[model samples]
Target: MMIKAIQLLVAVFGVLNLNGIECRKSRILNSFEYTAINCRVHSASIVDFGGVGDGKTDNTKAFQKAVNHLRQYASDGGAQLFVPAGKWLTGSFNLTSHFTLYLQRDALLLASQDVKTWPVVSPLPSYGHGRDAAGGRYISLIFGTNLTDVVITGANGTIDGQGVLWWQQFHKKKLKYTRPYLIEIMHSDKIQISNLTFVNSPSWNVHPVYSSNIIIQGITILAPVTSPNTDGINPDSCTNTRIEDTYIVSGDDCIAVKSGWDEYGIRYGMPTKHLIIRKLTCTSPYSAAIALGSEMSGGIQDVRAQDITAIHTESGVRIKTAIGRGGYVKNVYVKGMNLHTMKWVFWITGNYGSHADTHYDPKALPEIEGINFRDVVAENVTMAGRMQGISGDTFTGICISNVTIGMAKKGKKYPWGCEDVKGISSGVVPRPCNLLVDQGEGIVGMCDIPADSSAIDAMELKKCSYIG
Candidate 1:
């Protein structure tokens, strides 16, 4: 029964290497059943498709074959591909619709360092040029496009990028293409990426762009404190996404909400809205726990974050934008943030100054308003707030209430830095700027944690299992 598999791939796809999943990459005869969003009419192990997880051999073909073969069951009840315990080494693999990629608890999928394993793809329409280079960029280790009802979940399985090589190339200006992320899903819907440990990603770790109905939960992302551009969980141009119960330690922002960049973003014209973030813990010495744009020109709105915890981060929540970026960031609500050792508790600025190219219109201006924060506490803070807006166009409709921040021993003399922005503050420490002092406690009513329901709340996990 284990012999005859898929129609076309069964013949040429070749050998089963359960051996690689044991003895550090050797196959072992192991089988198990697990639960997920959908049960599979058919399932197979990577070993059945020449998988050598010995930590040395390249299992790229094996992974590709397994996914491609099982994809045929999509029209029936869907399919699942199980990856057992071992050190699996591979490069890039694409997922199909109605599929699940499950890794065992001890399984470690190591990314290949060989450039040939990675295929360079064209830049995103929202960003005309590559992020780090002038042209194309490497595809992610696990990529999927135009897919639906996909799940990339495991029982604390690990996906290690081994990104030192990529990082060095980026720092030395030796690469012609931008780096690849660990997992990227584009133009898809009903995606769930959870219960995974992602480390040392080449770039952003779980990027969902132009997608919707995504649930990213129970994730642990870790990278070196100095690794460049290793952002965790960047949701770009997506809607109705919920990111919860995630822990991250990184060099960049733990969670970055973006839409697009510059004129390309303006042209793409997709705003990320109706996002719900909850129970997130982050530690990043050089960046914010949560950031919205330095690249949001497509617009961003209807964001909600609550029960956030940050330790030794640059800021608790940061909004970054620049000129020539004609977007809007509005209807943002944040509450219940417990922060420690932060450069600033809240930060919003429009002088980020990174443009896609010189041709971006200088007359373009972003609309930033309706930002609210309440029920936040912080200790060991260098400063409380840094709110800067465009010189001529001041940011308005801001409110803050029920917040307390204790400054660091040798922190900045002035706890608040404000310019070209108007807001109302109540129950804030260190006495905010005169422009924000006019409001009373009524600001709390406006900025409190909203009781509203969103589309993402309707997404529910089901009892789905695969057998082997």
Candidate 2:
């Protein structure tokens, strides 16, 4: 059956190519690209299963029944769950493998605000405790585990998590478990989430953990600037992930790439690798636009980000780690970024002290190398870069070139601050700190952009449409 699906996809690709539609060979086409490929067309509407979309009815049971009825079609060439144009009020619901969840343009998936509706699950093995608490955690609104070929795409619908109560509880220290994410897929693969709008998540908006072969594109995620832990999208301990053409306004990092916490991560030993982030526009007054980690005890490598715009953000690109994080972050590259009104255009710290537990060894030092940034322009920057490394294990092989930053009128006394790190800078504004030696004019060769890489252009998806 899978072979048949592949053959159908190939035939449709041939047709599309013949019609002057260019498709790159570097990345696999998403479900929208192969809409003409016919497999088993087993589908059901949520409203047919007694789901009320009046914005007040509890559709949790309706959703469960619909999914349960559709699970049988997993082996019958997959199934699609269609959500019509209305407000769907539901609690947590599980997804099946080989399934597609499609929402119409006027549809809204409204999360139940009642705390009892959320289920409490055990902490991730890689992290012994919840990130915000000491025990279990609340499952996400749309939760799935160990599923394959799962897709959540639509005609730019909305998933609204009324998270004000959760935020209040967190601030008052009345929460027992960690707050839930908006959408979380764990231990799954071949996943695609696009053309959606996410708002007011309790914690992270979209989290894909311990998964691979994922694509997230053309989505908008928004949260209040003061909300706690409402990161836009966090790709945790995943491989072969691509995030592109997304806009984010969040209280935390727009795109935070994390693995596990200190000692737990070192033991899990699963690194997040081969990531591509491009064409992203972000705004966060108190957080970085793109943060590699404060939770990256597992190694992170081979990351490339380009063509990004950051406005009114705290920091542009941040790499955060501590002595207890016993992993290496290497081969990171960033280029073609535009920034405005930033506290610091770039920041890397070695003294971040957030920990899940006390079991992490204080002596386990982290390693950072091969960090490169080029072709960046910024304005109203207070400080250009503040890079701090541990005393013994200095961050090495850092390179910055072809970057121009205009400081604010009341900017910091020093534009750059560096300690315990060794690197070279060329054609950089404010003449980076003395720690970075002035390499000669021919230093452009130090920055390398990956050719033939799976960037946004390589994964351009067809605009999807839905009929209500």
Candidate 3:
């Protein structure tokens, strides 16, 4: 029955019959030519404060040696710096253009905890800023800057952050230590990261910031869901990106696509576009499996997500923008999804706010438009769904077809089968909004709204099966 359903859905949608098999074929290879790949690194492990090996635990020599080699080799083309297996402890190593850090499945890159050994960069407002004024800890376990044609791939081993100390400090003050992410990419292009176990991050796990043409595939990320600000894959101000065949169990959004600040978008003056997310599975300390912007001040559009599976997540598909996020999200295609367990099945809210309540600006909020959902199946949805549509202009050009929702639970008794949504979350319980129910047989339309709304323009449910 499941196979028959899938075939019927594919026939109805006319898209992606391959089921994401093509992605596995295109793993990052050394053949692609990009300037960032030509870096050379020091042969020995670095252990120094300022290039002086202090014996105690200084990786400065090793890190600086790799950086200097990169300055020479990266310009010619990229090259892989072989870090043989075993514990290669380091403070912080800067990433150069066109370089690959290939680990041999059994390798472990452990990080040092002593704060003084690490270096600091300029302050950014979005993350844990103003808390680490005397910045000493590394911001990323593996970091890259202004790079291209970079690949970090290996079948074995793990990059351990040893985050217990950092986690304790963050909980006590929430500002004293701003631990670096597990893997970070900033202002670079043509990046590919695959096949690594990124575990126990002090902060966000893998952050790709201000980059383009990026691919993050086939990684297993494990961070305690209770860990604060530990998002799995955060693509900030990026374009032409793809994330596939990965599994994430994190503290925050499994995959979040965002722009810049209220005016931060203007700071970079570039929006995120052309994103494709496929064959990914997620578990939570996570709020949403795949979310688009509370920080969409720079706008995010032309995104395609398919073949996603979520288990024990907060929400299945969420698009959250706020009054402060002034961008657009359109041309999205989400299909071939299998989701089980969660608070909400689908939620689209236009209200955005940071956890700290700082940096409040109204200019960031933009009208959300141009979204599509096709061939998605869900089981055991706790909360119905919330769609705000467009503020003054209705959420138009939106389509939900070939969706098979199993059940809606309401305690032990009086369980509602399925509910349709069409309403703005503004103060007055404005009548249930407009939701079209069309070509959907067996799919019942429950008109619980006592008042009237223009939200639902059509309702068609034909040749379908529903059980209440």
Identify the runs in model 1 with alpha carbons over 4 angstroms from their true place.
1-35, 442-444
Residues 1-468, candidate 2, lDDT per residue (tens digit)? 432343355456452332232223332422332231122346555754666777899999989877887788888767777676789999999998888788767789999999998999999877778977899999999989999888887788899998899999999999999999999999998788888999999999999999988898889999999999999999989988998899999999999998888999889988899899989999999999999898888888888999999999999999999989988889899999999999999899999998887789998899899899999999999999999999998999889998999999999988999999988888898899877888866664667676766533344443432221
Which one is best on TM-score? 1
Off by over 4 Å in 3: 1-60, 75-77, 125-138, 355-360, 389-394, 411-433, 436-468
Expressed as tens digits, the lDDT of each residue in 1-468 for candidate 1 is: 222232223335333334322111122234455445566666677766777667998999989988877787799878777787789999899999999999888889999999766899999999898999879999999999999899998889999999999999989999999999999999999999989999999889999999999999999999997999999989999999999999999979999999998999999999899999999999999999999998899999999999999999999999999889989999999989999999989899889987888989888899999898988899999999999999997998788888889999998998988898988888887778887765665443757757879989988888765555
**lDDT tens digits, residues 19-121, model 3?**
3211111222112212221232321111111222222445545655655554555555434544434466676677776566666545677777876665666
**Which rank order by TM-score, best down to worst?**
1, 2, 3
Which ranges of candidate 2 are over 4 A from the true structure? Answer: 1-40, 452-468
The TM-score of predicted model 2 comes to 0.90
Q: Which candidate ranks first by lDDT, i.e. highest?
A: 1
TM of each candidate vs. truth: 0.93, 0.90, 0.74
TM-score winner between candidates 1 and 3: 1
* Clashes (N, CA, C under 3 Å) per candidate: 13, 0, 45
Ranking by lDDT: 1, 2, 3
lDDT of each: 0.87, 0.84, 0.61
